[model samples]
Target: MECQVKANPQVKEVVWIHDGRPIHSFMATGNVEDSEKGVDSDLNQYQSVLNQRYRYDHHYQQQQGPNHHGSTIIMTNQSLVIQKVHRSHRGRYQCVALNDQVVPGCKANQKHQYGVSKNEQIRIRCEVDAEPTDDLTFRWTLNTSGTETAIEWPSFTIVNKTISIATYRPESSLDYGTLACSAQNKIGIQERPCVYSVVPAGRPDGVRGCAITNHSMNTLLIECLPGDDGGLRQHFNLEVYYGPNESRSSMKVLSEASAQSKSFSSSSSSSIVFDNQGVSAIQHHQQLRLHSNHSSSQPNFLVSSLTPGTTYTLNVYAANAKGRSQTVSLSAMTLASPEKHVARARDSETKLTFFFASEQEASNKSLYIRFLPY
Candidate 1:
């Protein structure tokens, strides 16, 4: 690694910085008369003071011995040589010349936008970078519709001389806007503050492209495409409804009391049956409810213990802290069990019989065999 320096004022010293820390430095070795000959006398005075404040370790010099092979200074002090360089040597490298002062700068390690609920508090953090962090201070501001206001104390805290945390809450619509944080030191305040936009949380978009992937006499496999989360964490829900295959008008109507009484146990919660006025008064079933934290490669649901040869209306909904999304509906039917069959054969002196049983009969009954002369 090499960093060449060419300055009119004759750089008083050069420091090699790696990952925000000084690793090595090269100081000019000459008489006072040679160092005083510079275009800017004021800058020369500043460099003298800076050299006193900023000190470099002699670790690099010690590594140049014959027993050491870590890092060493080569032909010129401007170049650095590292033996057996590996992953540990990977980082930001900077060549800093002591001539002027720099102002503080800050950046936030968060997304540009945040979804906030009404009266819900949120915390934001900022990282400040500057020389001489001893007298550093921080300030926060809120900007809404071209109007900016300073955030008072008790809402922000500074830690470790480099990080700042601010707590904020949006009470009304006007509080939704941009929040910014800045740092200041003995040199000067930051030119630009770290900014983040705040927006209101909303209902998630409805699931899409739902279809019955596979079905059997008592099970069905359904898959759907997920939608946007509406700037917040969201969950999924599947509702199953069973009704007759006839027209809507001819379908049977169930009383509210009867619908509520027909509740079944499930993994998440007890399922319930309800009736809609225009449509058939079908029996509703909560097949599955996945929480927001539930993660899967694909949004799929396997519904079991369903009735065979039955038509069902499936509705999928997405929900978040704000509200639930519109329903994405799909109509599917469970396969009907095949009928049983019997086969018989007779020879001159013997008889053979075969019986194929239906699913229910196979589960409930046992096979029987008999041998008799024809």
Candidate 2:
């Protein structure tokens, strides 16, 4: 935030006051004093507050104006620029000029707060009356730790009079709090604080390694490993698609054929198709009920009432308050019907080999019959 007091031939000194307290004082003779952040010199008795930082600059360059040369020259800058604004900047502000009897009006800007993502850059501004006095100066402060502290390098940088910007990165500091800027001179100070809050970054990457753990003639147990949750609590969704055992696209036709499975019901045997990519190719939807004791890295889900000797495509998703992650897929085939088993006896030894519908059916199972005579 920036505040300025224009200096006239008659004005001698300008003081900025905030909350009825004098913050800084500027003089037409090119002298500046900051009671809170200024460096102690032989001419000033105030101790330098190193933790409280404020900056002062004088604009001496000639600019086009109403003078005979079409330029307005100044002896002092009489301007205050806050490099960064925080929550502590809120308060009543008034600028007072001494000797010249011209008092600069001071009013605090509206108190406002902003929400930013991690590593986002934010800027807060303060504006003060800059009537003819040339003795006004600006100061900036931050109150992230409950106490007002001087904002410094690496986090804050000066933009211009009335504007200061700061960057907050999660890897660095965790403080996302208040910023303040004050306009002042020897007479008084006007200050206002702005609030700022930082939210965590976006949702995490998708889950990994979705595969089947166990399955029976009518049931299956699927497991997967989920990635980060974007710093939020997460849950897993297990989607199952069952059909006349057709292609991935055919599952949609199967779901359309069975309207009773419109929503997921524990008792429903029909599949429910979802619409995220091909993940909707499921015959049923089930939220994986996980115990709190279980780690989020690995989640397990159980599917029930599947047809004997049938194939199912499962898509799992990890979601949080922010959003859902990408889908991880698992294909499973149920065991053959008990009636399909045929027992054969050879020389008092028996061999068992289960038959499957196709090569794709064989790949979906964790166990294949071994040809060993027992």
Whose TM-score is greatest here? Answer: 1
Off by over 4 Å in 2: 1-199, 245-298, 342-374
Tens-digit per-residue lDDT, 46-144, candidate 2: 111111222222222211222122221122334433323333434555444443332233345642454445566555444455333356655555556
The number of the candidate with the highest lDDT is 1
Give me the displacement of residue 119 in model 1, in angstroms. 4.7
| C-alpha lDDT score of every prediction, in listed order | 0.60, 0.49
State every prediction's TM-score relative to the real structure.
0.42, 0.30
Could you tell me the C-alpha RMSD of candidate 2 in Å?
Answer: 22.0
Tens digits of per-residue lDDT, candidate 1, 1-374, equal 56565544355566654444445333223222222244253444444434543332222221222333243333245666655443444566566554334467755455667788879998877787776678998888787753566454358899999888888888888888877888888766777788877788888887887777789988888888889888776778776666443134434544543454445332323323222332333333343332112223346788888876666666677888888887665556676655311122222335567565677776888777675522
Pairs that collide in candidate 1 are none
